[model samples]
Target: MSTSDWLFLILQFFAFSFLAIGGAMTVASDMHRVIVDDMGLLSNNEFVTAIALGKISPGPNVMFVAVLGYQVGGLFGALVLTLAIILPSTTLAYYVAKWGQFNQHRKWVVAIKAGFTPIVVGLLFSTGWIIVDGFHSMKAWILGTLVMLLVWRTRVHLLILIGLGAILGMLGIV
Candidate 1:
């Protein structure tokens, strides 16, 4: 990639960092749009693979940003992205959390927390949709829907769900 493209990705990542309400995953769709659709830095499959790699082999799912950076710009890219994703959000969250602890019972604070619930839910849904959006088959749609339902409605273990998915994929069921 050109220096300009690297600069663009870094700047976009920094922007996403602040809006990562629930987590970095919440901003995955935006990342997909900019990185894959708008900038053409990576293909959709590569982007999805970064997410998968982050989730499956991770200290945190947020590490997916590192994968995206690495794909685009190697080790330096990874380090820069790691910082971009963490620094602003971490600093913001730290201050916000401290403020929240002090004002935990205030009406505005309570309202703000309540207000974010639906937003976080919507963001999470969008992120999931972005991941599922890649698969076009009816079977894939069904499986994706089933997983979404399981996640949204039930208390089932995520690992079990992941394992089940892996097994089904191995058997060519989904």
Candidate 2:
């Protein structure tokens, strides 16, 4: 990549980091827009695959950002994007957490927390919608609904669902 491309990548990720109010997952749709639609750095299948890999991985779901960076510009790109996405959020979270803790009893703080709850939930739902929409199949829709219902009603482990989904994918079930 050229110097300009690297700069744009870092700047984009840094901006995205701040917009990740609920979590990195919240900004996933936007990432798809930029990475796949706007920049054409990755195709839809590749984007979905990256997200699946990130979800199946043990650590933070935000690992998809690294996957995107790698797809865009290899190892160094992964490092740059990961740091860019994490650093701002981490720093802001640290200070805000301390402040929230200290002012836990304040009415405004409580109101702020309550106000953000629905927004966060909505953002998360949008993320799910974006991922599921990529499949473009009725079977995928039905399976997703079933999995969601199971997650909501049962004590089944998520990893088991992921494993089942993987098997279904391999068998061309979804």
Candidate 3:
């Protein structure tokens, strides 16, 4: 990539870093928007599959952006995507932590923390819908429901559920 291209990618990285409110979900959605919507780097199905793989992988799901970048523009793209997804959060977190400490006993701070609980839950539900909407069929619904129940009812490892889903997928059961 040229210097201009690198600069542009860096700017995009800053934009994503600043805009994402939550953690991985926010970064992942930002990546989806850039790669799928803006760049047209991958098809919708590919985008979803990439995200699923990212989630099941050992590390953070946001690393999927690097994979997409490598596919689209090799090493430079991967570097740009990583910088964009992570840098802002790391920098802002410092300020946020300081602010939280400064306002530790403030009533308004307490109220805001209380308010954020439901907002976070709502975002998580929306993320779930985004994932579930990609699956097409009654069977997918049945399996998803069973997995959801298992997650809710037991302390089962999430990887186990994800593995079962993958196996079912491979068997064409979903």
Candidate 4:
């Protein structure tokens, strides 16, 4: 790759890592902003579509890093952004683990967890909302509600629901 390509790759990698709060998936919203809004490399609709695809894949939602990288700068960009998306949170989780070991029984630790629980739940809810924004229709709502019920009531694998959704979409039912 050229020097500029390498530079952009490195920058994307670290930027993703820095945004790793409430887990790597939360970084999707920021990445959507970066790719669609700041970089003007993708439209808002494209951003949402890519995020849905990324979430449906077998890995973390941060897979959008690799997808965006591939679109922007080819294979090398994908590799760099994958690393970027992983490295920061891995480091933070490691440190957090270490800290937890040190402060295992601290009341402040319990308080901190209690404080962050709602924020984490809210982030997850927002992630779901952003992912489905492009699928606004009665059919989409019906399928989404069924999927939510499946997720809530049983041990059905998420991949199965995603696959069924894809099949339904192909049939123009979702």
Quote the lDDT for 29 in model 4. 69
Model 4 is weakest, by summed lDDT over 10 consecutive residues, at 1-10
> Where does model 1 exceed 4 Å of error?
1-13, 19-52, 55-61, 71-76, 122-126, 145-156
TM-score pick, better of 3 and 4:
3
lDDT string for model 4 (1-174, tens) is: 568756764677577687665566656767776667766776777667666777778876677777777776679767877787788778888999899879978999878888889998997778666656657687776777778788889999987887897898789876
* Cα-based TM-score, every candidate: 0.63, 0.69, 0.76, 0.72
Q: Candidate 1 residues 1-174, lDDT tens each?
A: 888877888888889999987789889999999989998889999999999999888398999988988998899988998899899999988999999989999999999999999988887788778778777778888999998899889999998998998999999998
Cα lDDT of model 2 overall?
Answer: 0.89
Q: Worst lDDT window (10 residues) for model 1?
A: 127-136
Model 4 clash tally?
0
- Assess the local accuracy of residue 81 in candidate 2 as a C-alpha lDDT between 0 and 100: 90
Q: Which should have the higher TM-score, number 2 or number 4?
A: 4
Runs in model 2 with CA error above 4 Å?
1-12, 21-58, 68-74
The whole-model C-alpha lDDT of candidate 4 against the native structure comes to: 0.74
- Candidate 4 pairs with clashing backbones: none
Residue pairs with backbone atoms closer than 3 Å in model 1 (clashes): none
Residue 20, model 3, lDDT? 72
Candidate 4 error regions (>4 Å):
22-56, 72-74
